[model samples]
Target chain A: MENSPKIAANPEKYTFILFVSGMSVKSGHAIENLRSICDTYLKGNFNLQIIDITTDRQSAVDYQIIAIPTLIKTGPGQPRTLLGDLSDTEKVLRILDIKS
Target chain B: MFNYFHKKNQTGVRKIKPSKPQDEKFSFPKTPTGVEGLDEITDGGFPKGRPTLICGGAGCGKTLLSMQFLIKGITDFSEHGVFMSFEEPSKDLSLNVKSLGFDLDKLKAEKKLVVDYVRVERSEIEETGEYDLEGLFIRLNHAIDSVNAKRVVLDTIESLFAGLDNQAILRAELRRLFHWLKEKGVTAIITGERGEATLTRQGLEEYVSDCVIILDHRVIEQVSTRRLRIIKYRGSTHGTNEYPFLIDEDGISVLPITSLKLNNEVSSELVSTGVPGLDTMFVGGGFYRGSNILISGTAGTAKTTIACYFANEQCKKHEKTVFFAFEESPQQLIRNMKSIGIDLEKHIDKGLLQIHASRPSLNGLELHLLTLRKLIKDFKPTTVILDPISNLITVGNENEVRSMLVRLIDMLKANNITALFTSLNKQNDNLRPDLAEESVSSLVDTWITVRDMEGIGERNRGIFIVKSRGMGHSNQVREFVIGSKGIELLDVEFGPEGILTGAARKSNQLQRTVKAMKLQSDLDRKDREIDRKRKVLEANIAALKNEFESVVEELGILKATEDLHSKIMIENTPKTKKK
Candidate 1:
């Protein structure tokens, strides 16, 4: 819902913002994949926010988003952006520097 | 953003209302770019509401051209624009265009322009699975709607190919992007880097088929020139020739006038050649207004002098004049002309004349022509003079110089500016067959040649009109002197050596006067001798008549003596005979 990912309230809390187009099959898979990965890896230690760019398109511009299902992990290290449906959970974790 | 495209697909409806019925039947709608000479080449401008691909190599002015289009649209046509830069950020773009006098910041503040910097960093991005460019569409739509922009510029959209992965998905997304832009109904320009094989690196020309413009920067010898060409404009007829364009402080100006047709309007009005005698040589007393006149000559044959005279004459008439002096600086030209009594400095001070002097090697021939074209446009001169166009030949080969001259002459003629060009030929070369003369002589309305007429070990300047189209020009070569009083064409003289000039002419005149004087004295001596002979004969006849009278008197006396004894000789002798 937020245009920018909020600063982690707790310094160690993993924060992620996922941007997607409205109701597309790829976007649906990306949302489910990210939730499952966060649940399995960090359990209740992470905050996840999902935004449909079709509705909050202004957020997409502010975030410099180009591809759909883009996930930005802003925590534990420098922020990193991930593209596509996030179906390759291992590749997404490797890019975000998350050991799972 | 998805709904916008989805709604259009479901209804198969165009977001833009169809153009006026008659307009649709006649011609496709066009949005004028308002760039100088570009609207003429496009035959109006880019196709309205369609994507146009502008491709060129790096530093070939592709971005500047697109920026000019957007700025000109807003400033000239009052249409707002959105600039989506895949290369430079908004701050950098503003700084770059500010040098060209385009205040992008001001335009943004006024809500007339929106610059969206789309940064796609490869290091920060990870491809997981299937994805589309819906985010780009969303950002572009938001920017366009914010300003209600009618024009959009996606400068070098090829940068996306570098940032994104998966060619199939990217290609499909690009297709959808173009379609979405069409639905938005804004005239859009998509710039691409030139490809080795295709028009664009990503072959963007394949997607944007409505119009394709290519910009080329070529360096011949050591000079570089920028040229523009319209490869295609689907529904409109456009000028397909490669036109030289200039990027100065004012932005991109394409020189689109290469008049292939000889159908320019002719003026019977005469513009003096500045030299009265030269004007008189043309039966009409001067050149036809708007006609091209070429004066080819050997070095020091007063070619520049004649050109200056023409410029001075135009300025005297209070008409503007632009003198492109290739050989001499303005100060030097003004000083040189002053020696011949032509005070060009005054005309310059009066703002009636502009002397632009540049080295021929400073720029390519195309740049020279572009510069001249710009000067003519700004000055709007009634007369234009290029002192020694031969210098331009040094920068380019014969064909290039000829083509440039063709464009230049056409531009001048179209503007109805009387054009005079001076060409310097080699010292011993025939003036007719040299580079400048051979190329431009045929295209000009008047071709005048000045040469060193060498006679009796002295050289004299002689001028003659080689050809004058549609006028009765003198077929005589008149000797001219460049005295302190300017160019004075002497009366045509035919001597024993034929068409004598200068010192030779003066010597021949003296010889003629001496011969005439000798003949006059010889006639006087012959008349005195004849009068003496007639007086002597008259005296001899008078003496013979007196002798006859005396003899008759003696005979009468003798007859009277005998006739007193014989009736005075006869009468007395006759009376004696009767007694």
Candidate 2:
């Protein structure tokens, strides 16, 4: 809700959906890493939705998720996917086309 | 470590139990793949509940083969399957196989199959940190559970290597994946791209070690052939030879060339050789029911005519016959045979005969053999004829042709179907059997050779039996004429210049008739002379008898006169004499 004003000001909305398979360490780390990056860099200008594929497998299939802790960055640019736990924040931001 | 957490996650998910017990794993059980001729080669099918590596080059039908396995599994065995394609999406995969009559959507709707296409694009993803392929595991688990699948196909799983970057993680994951599939108790097929040196580009053969099959497509002399060979199979004996396979409208069919053992059942029955004279040459009056007959001859020696006669005879007996003509087209053969009074078209219409004609160069020797095999399987004919198998030599060398014929004859013999093959020998090699004839002569049960016996300024066709196994046969050469009615064998004519035929035989008959007429006239003249002589002698004898009688009467008169004069003295003398 706090990122609403920024979301309207910036027409390029960073829509991110993270697909994970359960409450595993990698999934938790990936979710935390993606949130921290969005809050710090795109503050109030991004929308993030986390999906647990173990519970909602249809979405995992819809996103074509193969590796766990996968973050798909859609809208504002070409849709790109970041595999693994998103531990390398700099590389993820670069691949997602986010300017620091 | 990550492995410990993986174990906990797996246990927490569903308390999964491996399908087979540890001790029972040694007992090999197979799930039959419904592909024709495949089960026989594999000794059964893929090792059940384990992964099989199918490595092949591009466009060699690797994906199609795996798709068939999955579809056939569901349709034929009533076993559910999960197809995880790593290259093509589900829709494209379905469309690609639609022509093959695999109704993937219907199977999916019926809850008998699940198609999960795992699209991996390198440009779309960036590897950040250490990642386990737990997502793939979960998705596969979900699909398997949804369909309750007993079969799984990960077509071209080697694509994962190009999608991911970290070698260590991918290797560990692939190793685990095969193990997981085995633990899941589902028969799985993992396809891989052929490598230059190794069986698979990623060395997937190292991971899935239970069974490995290599599919190859090689083009030689502009003719392409697809072959399949089993590199290794644990716990079971399998055909190790490279078996040629075909991909047609029906799908892939592997032709397992040799049945290996010569244990086919034999039949004592006999089938007519179509030519009545040719049949008489054999003591059995015909060829053995399941025997292989070879008719080797020079060109224009009535070899095809003889073959047509045999085919006509079979059709007359209401037996199914298949004639594979390599030199002539079907219409041409039917027309040519019609000249010899053989009606092949009628038999074709009646569905009792099938004339499959193709140029020997149309396909590779293996393809021709496979086509013949498929025809025999579908038609289930009681008799098969290959007119002029010598034409096949143009497509392959002598050894290849001989081997193909061996397999073909073996197949026919095993099924108790009588087969006949006509071979054309070169004109120069008239004295001895040529390469083609000698190669096949030993394999045939009966060999009949038709040759041109050159006579004085003319040539005559001589038909004789070279060999007839298990039966007595005439050794004399019989003259055969290809007339409008059919092939007719004439009686053996022995003349001063050996066996005569054609014009020589006719002229010999004429000379014998002339000689007999002259001798009969001479005998009639001698009989007249003897009659004349007998008449003259009888006349003379009558005259002599008259003369003798007259003389005897005179003598008796003289004796009477003397007796009268001497009667007085004779009476006295007689009394004295009597005293």
Candidate 3:
């Protein structure tokens, strides 16, 4: 997966797992917003795994998720979690340690 | 903890039907809350493998009760539990129960318990579309699975409403969550905020859980009391009264007032009242060993003296005794009893007596009873004495005092401990009887009335046995004296005037003595006159005999002269005639 041209260009890899409640409007919006931010800021240097908590409940629990549509940045230093629909893009980037 | 859950498949579909009244075939198993008196009212405990709703206002011990349930489940029942708090963080929760001797950190370290804090910030969350509490479910499930918990607590579940604006979705998700907990076969406690009109603020009680318990904190007459009541239980018969509960350093303890039955074991042994004369007034020397005694009287009529005597008697027997002096301090009670020839300090020094002296106004009546219960349990006393229960009447109303005393007496009787209670009757209302005496009279087995009988220019103390069940006792009122030598019952004086006491008794004795002396003098005079008459008759008889003897002597001389004239030849015949 790392051999793709988009991921091979950058040495700094940001790994994230976004837990969502199925395909609800809020979960879908949170996933889209997080992907857009990653694509715009990281320039294909990040690895994001989207998990539907309704189906993959174990992964959600393993991350101690408490709110639906929660985004967790697990790599590149300390882990940080942002709850809700990820509507505040600036706060999300700051929490994920994304350089503007 | 993890290893135990590995043996059972996590995906097993065990459907838990919401218990219905008509479902006679299935009985919900109880989970023993392990609270002191809670299990008795809950019919062993909350419904097992079902969600029980506990709703109350703020500061009503909703969180403390849940914490105690979890801690007791882990320590007493050996059942692991998970505490998921939505209000206080895990650190605050642990620190709060530390005063109750619950080491939550140690339990978590031992893997027997798990504490998870779920923070739901209203500012951080924006609900835009349809969503579920799947994230909460996963977190709770993980916590439970980590400890293989048999009990689960969600403290303040209504806090989610504060963070989410979608009430319809929140309600639906909450219903699913309760059902899921039951399906998992774990006893769960879900606490909620009380509503103004409904049982829960968010109408959470509509979910039809297995049980619903409501806690209330109210201040009546400037005294605060916490009460617990079971709003509904699906399958079990439980106490329906609002039981008073206490939250102290030992956590929450519900006082089951009427839970005691009349089937406690009874003993036929008798215990002395410490006064020898008083013992004879009782049929079997004294009262029954486990029976309750009531000493009701007016002021300064020796009610406390009697109670102190009973306590002294118990302690002298090497039995533990606890004396609750509500009106006096320990030093004052000891000193007062010392003046009455009863040395209570010795028993206290020997460790056989425990004096708990406090003002009745210091706390509510329920707290006093709880304190007595705790002391009795710790000391294991064989005898308990409450000096002047009338003082307690100041703290509570008539009904509360009656209920408290009834529970107190019942507890003592159940433990087979002898109890003595003193009550003070008013001076003017002595003939009418006091309220305390009238209320507690029926509960006690022996009723001793001590009153002041004022007669003949002095006040005298009189004691009488009003009632003694199962034994014959003295029916006559005996006047008693209380001095530095202690109490002594004088014999019943039966004079023409009635029962005499004080100066009347002394005057009656004096009158009887004077009458006896006068009668003795009259008898002596009559005996002298009779003696003189008999002497005179004897002298008259002596004179008559002397005269008759002289006549007989003359006749004998004449006959001898004639006989001598012819006696020459008839000497032999004269001798024969003389013979």
Q: Quick one: best TM-score, which candidate? A: 2
Candidate 2 chain B lDDT trough over 10 residues, lowest sum: B11-20
Please tell me the interface RMSD, in Å, for model 3: 4.5
Runs off by more than 4 Å, candidate 2:
A1-12, B1-27, B522-579
Q: Model 2 has how many clashing residue pairs?
A: 1
Per-residue lDDT of model 3, residues B1-579, tens digit only: 242243123312222243444457565589999888999998889988988999999999988999899999999999999999989988998898999999999999999998988777766554433456779987788789889999999988888889778787777778788879989999999998999989998876534467899999988777777899998886677899999999887988889996356998899999999975899998799999899999999998988888888888899999899999888899998998899788988999999999998988888888998998898889999999998898888888899899999999989988999999999998883377778998899999999999998875689999999999888998988898888988888987878968888888888879878988998998899999998999999999999999999999999999998888787668656777787
For residues A1-100, write the lDDT of model 1, one tens digit per residue.
Answer: 1211232333488899999889988899999999898777666778889999888988998899999889998876899899999889889878876666
What overall lDDT, based on C-alpha atoms, would model 2 receive against the true structure? 0.86
Query: Which sequence of candidate numbers ranks them by TM-score, best first?
Result: 2, 1, 3
Global lDDT of model 1: 0.86
Question: Evaluated against the true chain A, what TM-score does chain A of model 3 have?
Answer: 0.84
TM-score of chain B of each: 0.85, 0.86, 0.87
lDDT of 2 by residue, B1-579 (tens): 475457447534422233335466543589888777889999789889988888899999988998999999998999899999999989999999999999899999999999999998887889988688888888899999999999999987778889889878887888789889999999999998999888888764444546788899998667778999999876566899998888877788888887889999999999988886778888889999989999999899988888888888999999999999988889999999888788999999999999988888889888788787778789998899998888888877787778888888888898898999999999894378887798889999999988998878888899999999999999999998878888888988878878889898999889888989999999999999999999999999999999999999999999998878887886667866776
Q: Which portions of model 3 show Cα errors greater than 4 Å? A: A1-17, A21-29, A36-64, A72-100, B1-27, B519-579
| Candidate 1 lDDT by residue in tens digits, B1-579 | 454466445433332333335565666689998788899899899989988989889999988999999999999999999999999999999999999999999999999999999998888888988888889999999899999999999986788889887887887788788878888999999998899999898774444447899999988887888889999876677898888888888899887647667787879998888896898888899999999999998888999999999998999999899999888999999999999999999999999999999999988887788788778877889888998898897898888888889898988888999999998888774434778888998889999988888866788888999999989999889988888998888997678757777776787889989999999999899989988988998998899999999999999999877757644456545766787
Q: Estimate each model's TM-score.
A: 0.86, 0.87, 0.82
lDDT of candidates 1 onward, in order: 0.86, 0.86, 0.84
Task: Supply DockQ values for each candidate.
Answer: 0.68, 0.74, 0.28
